[model samples]
Target chain A: MIRHPHLRLGALLLTACLLTSAAPLAAHAVGGSDAAFVAATRGPAPGPFLYLGAKHMVTGLDHLLFLLGVIFFLWRARDILIYVTLFSLGHSLTLLLGVGLGIGLNSWLVDAAIGLSVVYKAFDNLSGFPALGLPRPDPKLAVLGFGLVHGAGLATRIIDLGLNPDGMIANLLAFNVGVELGQATALALVLGPLLLWRRHPSFLRFAGAANFAMMTAGFVLIGQNLAGYWLTTGAG
Target chain B: MTEAIQPMSARRMAWLLGGATALAALITLGAVLPAEFNRDPLGIGKATGIAALWAPDEVRIDPAAGQQPAASAQGGPIRTLEIAIPLGPGGDPAGKDQLEYKVRLPRGGAMLYSWQAEGAKVADDFYAEFHGHTLAEHGKMTVAEYRKVSETANSGALTAPFAGIHGWYFLNTSERPVTVHLKVTGFFDPVAPGAPGNEAGLTARVGSF
Candidate 1:
């Protein structure tokens, strides 16, 4: 059973892989009964929007991938807080301004950028900079920038939903708060096992493989989103 | 032990990137492309069979082709048929409960149509859809939905989107009996009640939205 640690990591990665593959079928947007709610609803619905936001974060493989990559190697609680807060701040900014001011961006393009962000995180985790003979990027600034891009991705989805401006601010704030809460819950689940796993001697041996697998998942995500872009818009 | 601090060789980095890229490409070909666009390349799609996941549902054509008018070339009296469809018990919310009365219209032909449902006993909303569709040779159907709504009465002008069967679907939402009255004037073929043993064709097909 001592060999099961690698198996556990394999399960985690396989789950991520399956989820990432399945997610591209329907991009991160509202549909089905939720779409009916969004279309039929007449006025303010902070509670439902909050719930949806949390739900989105919970199921959003792209968001979870970036989160996992961000906290992969970090051991310090202070660093985790700082980086997560920065991401939250950046994410909340565009989600507010984009949806509030009715800023519009193409959803697939933003989603493609979000996918590329995952690739970036995975590459960074692998310490690819020195190998590629390039200077490393500052992790904080990188997260903030990608976080902004990620916010635009979220904004693109909400905007595409045709969210009515009535009480839009309240609903958006609720959604952002829900996102943070969901992130915290997900972090707890991921970090506990990860912290435990990091204490093992095999952690170093397997770290490279884990990052490589993550990079593969990210690349596949990018391909899927780009394919979505082409299929839905161009090359018809 | 100190490989983490070592500057990795270009050869090793190439192997890592190449292997990951190959894996990503394989996944995209096998699952992503097929499930999304049904574009199968490696026959992995045939193995996984996710290509059919996004296939467009078809509208079935029963052998009950309605009678064709003699003066179908126009300049004839406006073809009019009135049907009083009685809503049966235990209606289908999936549109199977709707009586689909279809008329074949030539491409670009204009058809004026109207329908109303009486509900003295039932207070439910009257639901119907006006749509036109044509079937391709290999079972692929191209459908253009004109209107779908809940109203007791509706009157509209419909220009045939293509050379195809176009008509109204009257759905009974409640168990209470509702009589649907319909009138149509157009250049088209008639959709008579039943053509032989096909009793199900009497209650034509209304697609669920």
Candidate 2:
């Protein structure tokens, strides 16, 4: 029911914004049921951990929003792959090193940083960064930096879970593999609609509106996490 | 690659920034602040009546939550209470969740307490906080946290610094149901479970040590 010509392309972005925002409230990594399972199980359970990893990525709202922003404007397969690979590399490095070395961060702070990642990507996608007086940052580098923050967010959660020392390496590797698969699956779903919408003539005209919606969602995420951090730490 | 996006009109760009700020402010004040920190200055939360849709990390607690100080338990024996907490998804506890067992103490009373989760290992981890809250002159409550963590079991002692409602707050971050076995030794009163965070009643369940 897109009446105005400008409404057509804006529809998908609006939907994505509304859908992700609504679901994010419940999008944390661990629930009581899952925690019970992890606590009861001993030794290396690579398979279950893999499933958990995939499940986390699939349902992780912050990461998904950032990924959507990443692939939103990309039309070429090669560029998408290159950017995705960079992200994978950055996150993989941090995920493994952060947990492996016992590098800890406050979960709220990490989450807030991830939200900032979304805002950054959406601003970049909308060409908002260029409008500012500052020189434009390299998109690849920005994505890579944000990917590290996103990975650290998950790493902190895992570290809190208290991983078993036995067969930990194998389990971590399997979990990382699961994350890639889940990211790929989500990417396909998000990219398909974007590709289809872009084929329509209304896409170019309304693209600004769509990206702005993304920016709005991203800002909401940042504000929410920041609020959480402030309330918990009592820091104004 | 997206073509260089034609610059948006100044007014439109301003609208984007302004609109996003407004939306974020609205959601924060209406939903997030009330559900998370229970700070609802705007009254929009009570009028609309919605839980926080963005607070996934809030430390969930009993909905009818209030810290009612127990009467003097100066000569009372140790009290043990078994509590069953059905922790919901996410860190935020719902209204009327968690067994907030409290005891009132005079200036210098002490109590020994131990609690453990009974069941399969919980991954989400159970967070228990031993704290005391004192009502000040004008009914303003001030609190001090003694202990908080997501562990399967915890055992320790608490010494009251002042006359107040001192007790333990438990939140299960796990997915399955876990019963918390709590044993208290020393001077304290037994307050009932789920008494709107205030008042006293009979223990919900009593189990042998």
The best candidate by TM-score is 1
**Model 2 regions more than 4 Å off:** A1-27, A233-236, B9-15, B51-209
Worst 10 residues of 1 chain B by lDDT: B200-209
User: What lDDT tens digits, residue by residue, belong to model 1 across residues A1-236?
Assistant: 26666656665675566445543545667666886776666667878988878877888878888998888878789888988889988888998888888887877778778878887887777878778888978888999999999898888778777777777778778878888888888898889877877877666666777777778877787777777777664311
DockQ score for candidate 2: 0.19
**Per-residue alpha-carbon lDDT of model 1 for B96-157, expressed as tens digits?**
45677777777657677777787623335567878877743332566777788777788887
Model 1 TM-score relative to the real fold: 0.66
* Model 1 / residue A137 / CA error / Å: 0.5
Candidate 1: misplaced stretches above 4 Å?
A: A1-25, A234-236, B1-7, B57-209
* lDDT tens readout by residue for model 2, A133-216: 347798889889888988898777777677776777887788888888889988988888778777877777667666666666
Error of 2 at A144 (Å): 1.2
Candidate 1's clash total is 0
